[model samples]
Target: MMDVGRHPNIKLLAYSEIESISGYIGNFHVRVRKKARYVDETQCTACGECAKVCPVAVPDEYQLGLSLRKAIYIPFAQAVPSAYLIDMKACLGTNPIACGKCAEKCDKKCINYDMQDEIIEFDAGVVIVATGMDVYDPTELEEYGYTRYENVITSMEFERLISAGGPSDGHFIRPSDKRRPKTVGFIQCVGSRSERRGKPYCSNICCMNTVKDTLLLKDHYPDVEAKVFYIDIRAFGKGFEDLFKRSKEAGVQYIRGIPGEIIEDPVTKNLKVMVEDTTTNRISEHELDMIVLSVGVTPRADMPEVQQLLTLSKTPDGFFMEAHPKLKPVDAPTSGVFFAGCAEAPKDVKDSVTQASAAASRAMTVLSAGKIKLEAITSVINPEICRFCTICAQACPYKAIKVEPKKKSIELIEAMCKGCGTCGAECRFGAIKMRHFTDEQTYAQIDAYLEEDPYNKIIVFACNWCSYAGADTCGGARLQYPPSARLIRTMCSGRVDEDWVLYAFRKGAPIVVVSGCHFVDCHYIDANRWTQKRVEKLWDKLEKLGIRPDRLFLEWISAAEGQRFAKTMIDIERHRQRVTKEEIEYTMKVLSEQK
Candidate 1:
């Protein structure tokens, strides 16, 4: 932390929060709130004088409330900047002449009760999000008796109690009696893999952390008994299994089952644990001096704020969703933004460092050239055809389009545009044109395909990233599909303009299938979502125009689902067979009349 503070290129804004974020990848505008610390960071030498004179005291959050600290105190011992920050909530305002003892005693005269929060605005080429994580609170479990019992504590509190700099001064003692615990019981997966109470996902660090804690116990107090109860140990990391073995060799009893109930003695405060030892195949009870709940980590409570600010997506586990799970692990769907540390998932120290370095490297690669190279496949707008309704801008997934109200024009940043063609698809006026995949080119393909056996053929629009690749996978595997299926490849499902689908129907097509990547796995952020919306509107249009809505099909196919692709094509062939020549003619007549 000290080294980072002194680094030449690193400007450490120690106590700052991101207030707002705007603009796209290369030119991002950021507003940060540098919270008032009261003491000037450059002037204060982190002397203990201010803390000594301060009357207001509060529980130190760093120690998990195991110790008390004055209102005017450093956040932690190894905190960067090494400056004291006054808690405005705890410190009575000096304007009303409340407690002003700390301000007077400050030899550096850096105390300023009137200090206000400063908003700093800056532009950056890239940004990294390492918002970190929060630990699960086991108090709500109630059965663990966390708040109900004095001897029961979470794993974090246990760390502080065992630390040399802790309030207990390196004495590992029970909270109830303040005596060294002879027998300690560690409960694993306290707030993880529980469908009813907590998150159902496995916390990556819990099992290994418990093992290390047990090793620490045996090292410090050789005679101290340490018992761990868990479903199973996960030591998949390099040398992690060896550490688990060492802990077991040091006499850490690893049980197979979790405790069903923990009952504390009313007088001694020793916990009575009732658990089924799977290995022994018998229910047993054990008395322990202290109970430690090996708590799990969770996404930060303020994660939704970051998600909203960046317009980023999240996975089922609530972590920030990467661009691609396997290919672009550290990259955000919103380009230029990268995730590191616990912000992505519950990772250990080593894994977090690895991801942080990777994110930094990715950011550096983007800014190294000083100029962004845009893709040839981008959207173009016709000023003459544009009605300035702003529908295209509203439908754009990337927010790449800029609409000028006074100028009555739309400006698109080519570098920012991902070439998804969602804006073009949503433009009712036909003002926008996707550069390479223009309306004329797509229409020409549809016309040529429908020119021969339009009634017997099935028209399929596939996204390049997934569905198109799935079709190629079918070909590579020699999987059988209907010979009548004519595929139209687009950059994204969003590129399948409604005009093409209608034109195919107007030419007497039997079946039109719109297939793309699964809703969550779109290559162009949320471009597939625009595809979904457009398909729904087209379905309504078809239904109102006396055409069967079922004739317009929507499917989400991934690159790995080649078998499903072939099967879907067969099903489309079967559906096509059901449509008679008369029905096709009627559909074509209805669509042509509507057009």
Candidate 2:
């Protein structure tokens, strides 16, 4: 942190928050709110004079509310800029009559309660999201007795208790009695891997953290007894198993079960832990001087706001979703943004460092290039034919389109567009045109595919990223399917215009199968959603036209689903075989008669 503060190229805006984010990938504009510290950072020498005179005291959040701090004090000992900041909320008031003891004591006279927050704006080429995670609160897990019993504390509190600069000054003591604990019990998964009250996903750091804590406790006081209650000791990291073995060698007891309940002895402030010993298949009760609930980590509370500002997407677990989990692990779906640390997932120190470095490299690559290379397959609009309806703008997932109602113009930002053809498909006035995939080209492919054996043929509309790749995977695996199916590839299932399906059916094709990436896993960030809706409309149109809606199949295929793709093709062939020649003729006649 000190290095970052001192770096000439780095401009660290400490105690500031992002207000809004705007513009494209290489040209991002940012607005920030620099909250008032009520102290001149350049003048304050971080001396103890002002803090000593301050009358107001509040629970120190840095110490997890285990200690008290004055209103005018540094956040921590090693804080950057080496300055004091007043907590306006904790201070008596900004008015002159309330309190001014700290200001009077300051030799540099940096304290100023009249100071106000400042807003700053800047521009950047790229951005990286490294908003770290917060630990889960154990208060909601009432069974753990976190708040009920003073002897029962969280692992974070335990950390502060053992730290050299902590309130207890490295003395590992129970909160109730302030005495060094002889028998300490650690409970694992307090707010992790439980569908009942906590997160269902595994909180990656809890197990190894407990292992290190046990070693620390046993090392500090050799005679002290440390017991760990857990579902499993996840010693999967490099040298982790060896460290786990060393902890056991140091006389740390490992119990394979989480305690069901904790009962506190009112007189002695000791805790009685009730748990079924899974290894022995018997219930047991253990008495402990102190209990530490190893809590899990969760996404920060402001994740949704961050997503809205950057136009980013998130996984179901609330972590930022990468563009592609395998190919672009650190890259955000937003063009110039990337992710690092626990903001992406619950990762350990080693993985977080690795991802942070990767994100830095990605940002550097774009910065060095000085220019963004847009793909050739981007969407364009014909201003003459456009209705300025803004449907294309509203339907765009990337927010790449701009609308000017007064000017009667719709502008497409080619650099921002991913060319999913969703806007083109949604444009009823035939104004939008995709670069590579156009209406004329798509019609040509359909006519060519159904030229021979039109009745016996199965016309399949496959997406370029997933379903087409799925077909290739099926063929690569040598999966046996009927040869009568002819596939027409589009950038996305959204690119498959409703007219294309009708045209294929009008050409006497027996069946049409439209497939794309799964809805949640769309390559173009939910472009396949429009595909699903368009298919539903086609189903209705077919039904109303005296045609079997079953003749049109909608399947969600992924790049990895080779077997499933093969099965879909085989099913479509079966349906094609069942379609009579008379039925095909009638369908062609009906489609041809429509407009």
Candidate 3:
């Protein structure tokens, strides 16, 4: 980030946050809230004279609470702009008139306590989101004794303690006693790969990081004993396995198991970890001078806020979702925005840098092009049919539908829309229609299929990308299934309007199946989630209308699941046969009457 900030082409704005993001690719308007620094960056020389005489002292966050810093100080040694910033929240001058000594001592007179936060706006062709990640606070896991024991530290704190510029000047000493430790224990997966407390996905860096730390410890003190407890060691990266072997050769004992509890001795403040070694089939306890929790990475707590701000989607793991994980790894569902670093998933420094560079390249691709070409599959609002209810805008997940209040109509932004057809499906007034799959075209297909034996046949609405492809694969594989099933392909399951489902039942179709990509695997990224919710609501409506909810089925059929697709069709056909013609006719009558 410091390197990016140093780039001459990049206008790095420090202490700024995105307030609002509006517009589409090749033309985005962004509003940033520039926080007050309280010091003039152009005049401040960064000399320590003002800080040396400053009276107010506070805990230095850069040192991880291991050292003290003046109220007016640089955030870190290599901070950009090299300007002193006043901690207004802690500064005495901001609260009371007790301190102005720093300002009095400054020869350049750069200090100013009256500066207010400023808002700035800019136009950008593209955006790269590299929000990074936050380490899980092991203090939440009380079993680890993190906050209770001074000797128990997080992996981040351990990094700083072992850093050359860190407090104690690169010396590895226990926080409680400030003495060199003879034995050290590292607990792996403190906040990772656990359903009970932390996340389920592997943090991808903890195993190698522990190895790095162990090597660093061995280099510093050859005689010091280092033991690591892990469920499994993941050495998948380039040269990572060699580093793991080096750590093992350096006398770092690798134990395969997670520690159940960490108890501390009151006398020496030593941490005692209890674990059952899966390798030796024996339970053991180890007392160490310091215990470092190899905590995992989690999506930022404010991730939802950012998602809402940028109108982005999140994966089940809470990280920002990419448009296509393989082909478009750095691109978000929103065209203009791209993802980088741990914002997409847990990654190491190398992976983060690589992804960050990829995101930069992807953003540059858009900026280099004067304009972006959009797909014609976007939805269009029919002003003549519109009721000005604004339901389409509310239903639009991408925020692509705009309600023109004065004109009393709705407008669709083609570039912004991903062609999910959620707006068209949610509009009760028939105001919205998706391109290539209009209301007339979709209903015409239903009419044509039902013209022969609509009452005896089953109507299936399948998403084009997944369920429809699955059906095609099932046919190509020669999987035997009921011939009565007729499939209609749409861009997404979200495009399957509730009215279409009811129309099938009204036309005397014995069964109606709505299928799409599996949850978390939607091509549109979470569009199937909306399909699931819609189907659940329709189930309640079916029950109220005296129709057996069993007649209406919703299944997730992936593109690769050919056998499952054929089996599902066979199962639905068999179930449909059980429903007598009288029952089917009765349900059809009820649906028609309701319509």
Q: List the residue pairs that clash in candidate 3.
A: none
Off by over 4 Å in 2: 94-97, 572-583
Task: Give candidate 1 misplaced runs (Cα > 4 Å).
Answer: none
Residue 514, candidate 1: alpha-carbon lDDT = 98
Instruction: List all candidate RMSDs to the true structure.
Output: 2.0, 2.2, 2.0
**Better candidate by TM-score, 2 or 3:** 3
Candidate 3: residue 363 lDDT (0-100): 86
Over the full model, what C-alpha lDDT does candidate 1 score relative to the true structure? 0.89
lDDT of 3 by residue, 1-595 (tens): 5786779888988878899989889778999998998899889999978789888889999888888998889998888878899888778883557678888989999988898889999998888888888888888899888889998998888998999889878998889989989999998988889898988889999999999999999999999999999999999979999999999999999999888888888998888888899999999989888988999999998888789877788888889989887899999988889998999999998998899899998888888877788877988888888888887777677788888777885678888888989888888888787899887888888888888876668899999888999999998999987899999999999989999998888777889999998877787756677788889999999999898899999999998899999999999998888878888789878987887
Candidate 3, 506: how far from true, in Å?
Answer: 2.7
In candidate 1, what are the lDDT values of residues 1-595, reduced to their tens digit? 8889999998889899999999988889999999999989899998879999888889998888988989999988999999999998888758675778988899889999888999999998898999998999988898888889999898899999999988788989988888999999999999999899978889899989888899999999999999999999999999999999999999999988899878999999899998998999988888999989999989999999999788787777777888888888999888789999988889999999999999999999998977777878999988888888888888777778888757997888786788999999988898899998999998999899989778888899999999999999999999999899999999999999998899999998989999999977788867888888889999999889878888889999999889999999998788888888887889888877777
Every model's TM-score: 0.95, 0.94, 0.95
lDDT for each residue of candidate 2 in 347-460, tens digit (9 for 90 to 100):
999999999999999999999999989978989999999988898888787889999978997788887898899999999989999998999998888889888888878889
Q: Score residue 247 of candidate 1 by CA lDDT.
A: 97
